[model samples]
Target chain A: MSEDKFDAIVVGGGLAGTVAAYLMANAGLEVVLIERGNFPGSKNMTGGRLYTHSIEKIIPGFTAEAPLERKITRECVTMLTDDSAVGLDYRSTRLGKQGSDSYSVLTSVLDQWLADKAEEAGAQIIAGISIENLIVREGRVCGVIAGDDELEANVTILADGANSLLAQKIGMRAEFKPSQVAVGVKELIRLPASVIEDRFCSSDGEGTASLFVGSPTAGSIGGGFLYTNKESVSLGIVATLSTLVEGNRSAPAMLEALKRHHAVAPLIKNGKLLEYSGHIVLEGGYDMIPKLIGDGVLVVGDGAGFCMNLGYAVRGMDLAIASAECAAKAVIEASGQGDFSAESLAVYRTLLEQGFVLKDMKTYRRFPHFMDSTPRLFDEYPRLAADTMEEMFVVDGRPSIPLRKAVMPHLKRIGIGTLIKDVRKGLGSL
Target chain B: MMEYVDVDEKLAVDKFYVDEDNAHIVLRELGPGDMMQFHTLELACPAGLYECLPDGTVRFDYAGCLECGTCRILCGTTILEKWEFPRGTFGVEYRYG
Candidate 1:
């Protein structure tokens, strides 16, 4: 018997929505998960890493079954300036532990798996349909309109995405500023598994996550990332829409420049191109979070802006999964009271406040501002690092200067005060 | 031996703009609104899905688009200007993604 009505309607079959549906349905509430893609992941993309701490709590030991790409055991951060690159590398066996390590999986693969889990948990999964409108009556969301179908629910979860028009349609989220978002352009380059492992200096199944600052974005506010997969590498650049536009560099052009970079080209020197995707990522942290709760409705994932870019690390998947858990728990508690008003749904905020989702965002609240305001870190700093390293290594026997004497001129050019001030600001923010 | 990424192979797999009508059709009907608003979008379109007409009306070719979401976001008409995943298992299927 298809009841046509559900306890909750979860929009967007990505990690947050599917996990929320999975949990709520497991808790004995009827759930319907909706996705516009033909399948769960057809429309999605990412930097391709999922930090699994949160997901492990809900679906324990799930990694044994998930389509994981590689276990990241080596971390590399490269500062590039065309012909030169200065890198910091760290390798540790500690990163390979289950429930703590992160892996790179395409969203198309991961989201489909999550949706299947929700479906297996008795939540109805609906694909190949876009929710055209929210069914609101008397200031409360009650159902959704998809094409000719109108399905009713007691509560609605809007986890659609960063440019979620559905959240804005109900006046639940406001128009975001350009500075509040970034446009990420990505290319998945396919190399052999052995070639990938050898190039990244990783063991057979292990992989590396490389982040590039400076030349990737043509000295823009954003940076580039590369994560090794089983037989390919995920490489891309994320630039603030404002900066990319003002800097007169297309996101595609920036990605091309990054691929041609002397330090980046050799890694995938003979690989075939696999896929390309562009996504609008939420850049603004705590400050950009819109109204999270409303009558019979709650927002999660990128719609709620749960992503954080803290220079060294860019995280969204774990945060998405975490938000899903909190949202599910909140919905369950609300259903227990038989109340679906804003007052009842406020439990979502409380759970986020007590969890890592909000805590991490609050900690990095000042970092985005620092990154945006400090342009020198992108332009001058990478060149200085590369130049200083080159000066130290060159021994032409033509009167070699002392180490400090060699580096002082470059430091003096940017001034010691600016470097000191930037360090202080970076420390204070991070 | 090429020093760059083969985006054409990627473009071959990924689908293009989807909506009630072609994106450029909707944008044209909505009017460019402002040329400056179209600048970022015009430059950022990786698939080169668009072109400008003689008098400055932007002409769009939806074939081989990477569907990067830039034109939709950078458009003054906003994301409402019709860009979606091609219907039902029709877009890029990643081999290693």
Candidate 2:
């Protein structure tokens, strides 16, 4: 019965937890991963894209056997202003290249695939249980209390999703602020695979990852996104929670409005809505990162607020995977040294600093702040972009004007100083 | 509330453990003289299952709930006191997720 106490006990069976468990189990450690749902991915949610660079670092040939939706080789960023739309569409064969490319994934299947990988590597998965609290002794977390069972471990990892309750109960995480988190609501619309291909202009098994700003949130400080799966599309909006209630715009209403918008309706015109899923997203970058290591305990993935939403793209799964790998490495090293002290487990932070996970997050730390303060980026800028495009293309039986002459006033409305300042700031942050 | 998007047939299958009388969730059941401050209940529901009755009671067809928790939050279930994830292996199983 003493052997029941595993080397490591992982709470939450999402991508981060599963990845960490897999890596640690692969390192020949006894790992038990617990999930509240019947399966790992059952409770996971994503806006539908996975940047594969980090995953490749772990499993070199993961995509060969992984359950993936599509290789997102084509991308679009659209700015919508009520009746107008300005789109920037770019496709490259290079995006389809092996290492640097990304793909759209349904978390339901993807999470299970990853958890299965960990199981294959000897991680024991305890499903259908929700851990209520951490078992702390002598100021160190040694296990978790789930229902009537107290499963012990040398080290316990919190890989639960954003704003983890267990982490908060242990005084490791803060009560999430509405300003720091965004509520994302997504709908899966099923279309014929060929229809999706033709509509998004991807003929050869490639897909589109498109984002929308402005009217999706009714010009609030949030945006909408669309990612094409093989036979369906994941379309949704993520609004800063701070702006929801006072602004009188609920997330579901915003989604309803988004689906009915003329600019967006055609994208999923004849499709069937497969699912409606919503989750809170952490938009807080570096400043929001909690104290990651504690005595005999560590936190990884969303529990540590490792997601980055840079407006153009949102990345968490890869960061979660990458950070979990680091956490697993730190845990493995600490256990081998027979030390799980907070001082010893601090190596996890070092691993993150050494890896691209924390480094990339630090780079974009200022971006979320920029997003929060700049209302024009969501409202004025998108309209300006759409209006500028409308002016450029519309031939109203008037004499053609020089391109600069036509576009200058729109730029002038948003002063040249503002544009330059924003450009410089954007470049600096990204 | 109004027809916006056509939901999949799978949502019609009920997966939640709900007690109608003791729902624990709070929603504004409009009265005869009350002007709807906002159609919040209708807006939060994506599957269009909520119907306002003549006596101001709401007929919410929770069977079609997607469990998105949008309405759960908007309806004043702070910290999700009333909402719980449907039991293991129940609820909408996203084939595509």
Candidate 3:
């Protein structure tokens, strides 16, 4: 092969890399994007929700032509126990209009389409090539070498996924401890559109996303999520790696247990299992994020641990894109000055901190730690509350006590003092 | 409807086994005849027990095996032994690990 020099080399063709390549190429820079998979998103997976704001910034008004499955119109958070579930559901027709803020997207379809957009903008994407290592010269990363091919560039961007080998190779991140990561296993269950709509109580083209906090992981320190697709449902469980190790459970067994749950079985009763996939997620909030910018390279997406699992939704893809866009802008600035030093790349960190990508992470940095230490909130509290309510409202032949009396006994049974402490901790963390 | 016959026509032996001394343990057959059974077991250990290969395969050290089977499930292929260490020392000892 010929040795070609580009202005920038992007290692990883996921959403972050593709967006960076797109922006750089549009700005009239020669860029090459190397992907390990057969295509941009062949090995990618998510819970099927994409925020429109960040994506629109990259490609304006993409929803009109993008491969979007459904507009998210309703969101539900269910606190479940062994026998009952207490849910908070919200539906808004305002979020289902032509220009919605978010939509459910299949990553395989969306990433492929985004790659096409990047290629249209003159970014050369070479797929099915695994980047072996970063070409470091004098303690500075200058390019990437992939399997007998050495590509030279002024700067290299690492947009590899959570289990990023490139970032580890360059010493941008250390070996991830189990506490800082999570293993998520998801299944795309195929069902008729009508059946999905009825099951989720959604209309045509309107979707629902539900989050579960208990029984799914079997009292582990993680949660479960179910997102509605066009003709399928994306259901999965994400547990802290440390929790999974401590609990002696496997992700597949947890998924099977979730499917067997009384509260979850009815929604996927007759659905066909179309595909099963699993991926690692960095869930340690802001504290677990690695060095964003190095001497001659910048890391984006899960490589930098830019994910927020806020008990209600997972917001990493948009943050990844936003961070990549910030890095692209920094690259443009660095290119003008002909400098690719650590000082020049520090602008990427400043931009991310100014945006919601890091600000939100810092705001809820204590969430994962708090959730891990409080298992009773996920398992016992919800059940006790539901049982108390059931007893108060059942009203058999026997005389019924006051509502306050029924609730107080249950609260006392679980130690009201500890419950209050947990509430305080939860409120503080949120 | 098409009728299916059992390929192994020998007497169906009771595959369920239990250690009489250990009441907490019970093992049962996972599949019918001519099928490989994959048993999952969990053990605790610190890091450095396994190494991830270039082709995304992980090799476990026999002496430091935790027997977690995390490597097996993450491999995405069924061409692994996925075994455990012997019931003795030379394994993981996790204390607040």
lDDT of 2 by residue, A1-430 (tens): 2337889999988889999999999999999999876788877778999988898879988887788889999888888888888888888887878888899999988989999999999999988777878999989998988657798998999998784767878989776666787778788888999888888888766889999888768656788999999889999989876665446555666787788889889989999877777677788898899889999899999889998988888899899999999999999999899999999999999999998888999999899888877778988898788878888788899888898888888989988899888888877788
Better of 2 and 3 by TM-score: 2
lDDT string, candidate 1, B24-72, tens digits: 2245453455666666665566554554456776656555654445666
Better of 2 and 3 by DockQ: 2
Q: Candidate 3, residues B18-68: lDDT per residue as tens digits? A: 223322212222234212212122211211233334564444434422223
Worst 10 residues of 3 chain A by lDDT: A244-253
lDDT of each: 0.81, 0.79, 0.72
How well is each residue in A1-430 modelled by candidate 1, as lDDT tens digits? Answer: 2447789999888888889999999999999988876777767788888888899889987777888899888888989998899999989988868768898888878888888999999999888777868999999999888756788888999978776778888997777676778888888888999898778888888889888899778767888999999988999888887677777666777888998898889988988877787778898998989899989899999889899998888999899899989989989999999999999989999999999999999999999899988998787999999999899887788987789998999999999999999999999999
Ranking by TM-score: 1, 2, 3
Task: Name the docking class for model 3.
Answer: incorrect
Distance from true location, Cα of B9 in model 1, Å = 5.3
Q: Model 3 over residues A5-60: C-alpha lDDT tens digits?
A: 77889887778999999999999888888886567875577877888788886787
- Highest lDDT: which candidate? 1
After superposing candidate 1, which stretches have Cα over 4 Å from the reference? A1-3, B1-9, B15-25, B29-33, B51-57, B63-68, B78-97
Model 2 misplaced regions, further than 4 Å: A1-3, A399-409, B1-95
The residue-level lDDT of candidate 3 at A100 comes to 48
True contacts kept of 1: 0.32
